[model samples]
Target: MKKQQQLYKGSLNTIIMKLLENHGRMYGYEITQKVKEITEGEMNLTEGALYPALHKMESEGFLDVEMERVEGRVRKYYKLTESGVKETNNKLEELESFVRNMQQIMNLKLS
Candidate 1:
């Protein structure tokens, strides 16, 4: 795997939650495309990876799913639940802390 892909694999859930938190709700493909767009195509989320994570989060009560008919097909949308919002904040905090530690260890300039 490329470096970016490898790095992103560890934080897919946080990324998805943050997106939902910002966007309200999104279908799977929309989430994938948004990630691609935001990352300038450096990151591509495959269905194999995305669906399982969504299902797991839904089961864990971090997300809720809605089915909507669009263009003669049913699309499943994912939205963050109340607990999800809290978890997203926690995950973002953890990620930020990790980054700060890494910066200090590497003697990198803080942002």
Candidate 2:
């Protein structure tokens, strides 16, 4: 029930990539729920946003999707491709650097 906002656009991909890195493979709903839980409800991703990113990543060869029949529904599970694993690491590093720069600019310390 959280509203979608512009700031969440690019970062969702990184979050998904990181989740896949840790969780191995997961379905769409599971990904959404996990993100919500991990962020303590601060980040809420809509299917509209999530599916496109998943599909885009798959099309780009960053993710591999496998369909499995579960209880009458086809659940599309996603995992990182080799490229995705590399990309995840790079993105995380980039995010870390960005955070450090922001901290410097703001003259803030994490203590």
Candidate 3:
């Protein structure tokens, strides 16, 4: 699985939050498409993982859900709550720090 590669598995929440942070709100499918678009299909987020994380965030009060009718079907959109906004910022910082550390650690030349 793409999630098992490198350190991406841990950053799913960060990735979702950041996308919601930028896009304001999105449904599960939209989030998956966006990730694929951004990563050029390198990363694939499975439905099992995405929905559970979304539900967990919803339960944690980090996300607020809005239901809308589109194409004769109800679509559930997830928006970041006030607490989610704060959490997103924190997660972003944490991810950035980790990336920088990894970069530095991997910068060594093989002699």
Return the top candidate by TM-score. Answer: 1
Deviation of model 1 at 7, angstroms: 1.2
Backbone clash pairs for candidate 1 read none
Tens digits of lDDT, candidate 3, 1-111: 543544676888999999999999999999999999999888888898899999999999999999999999999999999999999999999888988998998997889
Error of 2 at 43 (Å): 1.0
| 50: Cα error in model 3, Å | 0.2
Where model 1 places Cα greater than 4 Å from the true spot, the runs are: 108-111
> What are the lDDT figures for the candidates, one per model?
0.95, 0.91, 0.92
TM-score of each model, in listed order: 0.93, 0.89, 0.92
Whichever of 1 and 2 has more lDDT, that candidate is 1
Each candidate: RMSD:
3.1, 3.5, 1.7
Error of 2 at 103 (Å): 0.8
Across residues 1-111, which tens digit of lDDT does each residue of candidate 1 receive?
A: 578788898999999999999999999999999999998888999999899999999999999999999999999999999999999999999999999998889996679
Error of 1 at 40 (Å): 0.5
Ranking by TM-score: 1, 3, 2
Give the better candidate number (1 or 2) by TM-score.
Answer: 1
C-alpha lDDT (0 to 100) for residue 93 of candidate 3:
93
